[model samples]
Target: MGINKERSAWEKVNMARAQERPSAKQYIDRIFDNFMEFHGDRNFGDDPAIIGGIAQLDGRSVTVIAQQKGENTKDNIFRNFGCPHPEGYRKALRLMLQAEKFGRPVICFVDTQGAYCGIGAEERGQGEAIARNLVTMMNLKTPIISVVIGQGGSGGALALAVADEVWMLENSVYSILSPEGFASILWKDASRAQEAADIMKLTAEDLLSLKVIDRVIMEPNGGAHKNIDAMATILKDRFISTLEKLCSLEEDKLLMKRYEKFRKIGYYKE
Candidate 1:
């Protein structure tokens, strides 16, 4: 899609949350082959919101992990609106560790509003689950690539996002919290979400400028949903190129680079 330079951050946020936007399931179906879905955390029930499996990408085995959001009401309810519980994070961690064991790269598609804050999820240790993933991912021996395919909100998104290379779709967004939440916390009015988005620097381009993401994948003129075939092709190419580059690095170097990458993320003027 032709880059719309005039689009504001708030506009990009809306686009990222568009109901017609492509979900993680769609990306898996289009970009990979021989996907064998593995279910459950082996401690609790499987979480539909976090889908993890082994898939073949360009004839190479890779672990595919993503947060799945439903397009319709029925599906959304079934998937908990893509808000994962503690079990979902645990499931993702299991797959990542398994990928490392087998010497396969881990590819993550991040799209979530954050971990579920329900009492049950809290009782199950949601914070601990995400925290574990963050620390473990930092030290993983295999290459990790994370793509923000849609709305990436808070720690739920970050749990899957710690990677050697983090990419975001041109119209996607990644932020510490949702615009509505930011508005509520800052202005005591959720209606100022548009205003909050303006100043939040959460858009893909904005994040890239801030060095928050390594790259940006351009979508179709309107959006990825507008041209799935073209979008998928570009995404596939980008993934392959990135994977090839990361694969060339030694495991220790990869881990060190990943650690250093995140260590330099924030601004501190001397």
Candidate 2:
């Protein structure tokens, strides 16, 4: 199982914000009902890294897209450790478009280290795929919400994060670059990853303070994995409330609000 042993003391104290899990798929499957999974990018083979389907929450239908990582070596190979290729983002874009056309509220769960950086993915237009998704999500006319349930790094997270509202589980991390990646580039030492993580201010609380995230979803005392049912219930309630609020707004207003939310992300005065 993937473990987080290098976190600082403060991070350990906040570990109750969300539970460390062997995998998020289990929690999602247990919480959602009547889920019908979709497959394939249509132009290319399906990417297991991105999973999307229609499901019911409290008997209300919604579309969900989640980045799925694996628990074991075999599953990791299968899911690509939640690192998606170009086709995976394409598939996500297709689902988002479908949700928009049908006027369904879309919910996305982000849990990726980043988009796959393999030569094959680049050759297949990885940059273009992520860029296209970013634009499409920005202009999407439906009520869309994204939750960063775990690791939300680089372009992979951004692809699904351009929503009407973005939430992050208290323990989850979201950053433009992974700590190790940043450390390698800035310090020429991957060993400085912990320092990079501290400096990135990627925690939910930090992002909330910066207004980069709409809210910090509380997790169980010990973590989400410690009490999956409680976490799921809280998530469901929050999602319902947020969706109702978003749905009440006019389409133009909703779009403007989303645009303004993003535009104001880096606002600061010296």
Candidate 3:
């Protein structure tokens, strides 16, 4: 979507969560040549909320990791509505480490409301798992790129987003928390989520201006669901161009720039 100042942030939020919007599986199919999905975290089990694998992007092998949500109630339950657990984060990190080992570029897609907050998830060390991903990705040797294709909420999204470059779809939102959560915690009124959205600066346009994201991938006039092919085409081009630039750098330089990218993400004036 083109930058539309008139579109309220909350409306964009709704669009990002639309069921008809093509999910990570859809994007992976269209953008990559052959995808071989890997399973399990080695310790606990496999997680459907996250899908990771080896794929050929423009004839170059790359690791593809993405958070996935289902289109219907049954599938959503199976996927935990794309809210991953500790195992999901571990799976992502494992695939990332594999990428580093094979000298392959890592591409991540973030689209989660947050990690699963259920008692069972906490019992399995969800926080620790997410934290480990952050530490590992920060120092990983391979070039990495992450795109927020939909709801990138909380630490769950951040777990997969510590990359050399982070992009966001025009209608997507990447925030520390949902506006409802912010309003509920701050004002004790979840109904004031619209108000919270106005101040959160979660939109791709807002994030790019704030230096929170590297670029904004334009969607259709309404959203990605309006024209999935067009959206994926633009996204594929951006990925290829960026990957070429990143893969050209020396390994040490690649790591340094990724480090500096996060260090420079602040809202203050120079």
| Winning candidate number (lDDT) | 3
**What are the lDDT figures for the candidates, one per model?**
0.91, 0.81, 0.93
| Cα displacement (Å) at residue 125, model 3 | 0.8
Of candidates 2 and 1, the better by TM-score: 1
* TM-score of each model, paired residue for residue: 0.96, 0.90, 0.96
- Supply candidate 2's per-residue lDDT for 163: 87
**Which of candidates 2 and 3 reaches a greater TM-score?**
3
Model 3: per-residue lDDT, tens digit, 147-237?
9999999999999999999999888999999999999999999999999999999999999998889888888877889899988898899
Model 2, 1-270: lDDT tens digits are 222335552363234223246255765676678889999899888999999988887777888888888767788899998899999999999999998888888889998889999999999999999999999998899888898888888888899999888988867888898777888999999888778878888887778878888888877765777788888888888888888878888898888878877888432222
Ten residues in a row with the worst lDDT in model 1? 261-270
lDDT string, candidate 1, 1-270, tens digits: 445678898889988888899999998999999999999999988999999999999999999999999979999999999999999999999999999999999999999978899999999999999999999999999999999999999999999999988999999999999999999999999999999999999988888888989888888888899988888888889889889988998877787788778999442222
lDDT of 2: 0.81
TM-score for candidate 3: 0.96
Candidate 2, pairs of clashing residues = 18-224, 19-223, 19-224
Alpha-carbon RMSD, each predicted model: 2.9, 4.7, 2.5
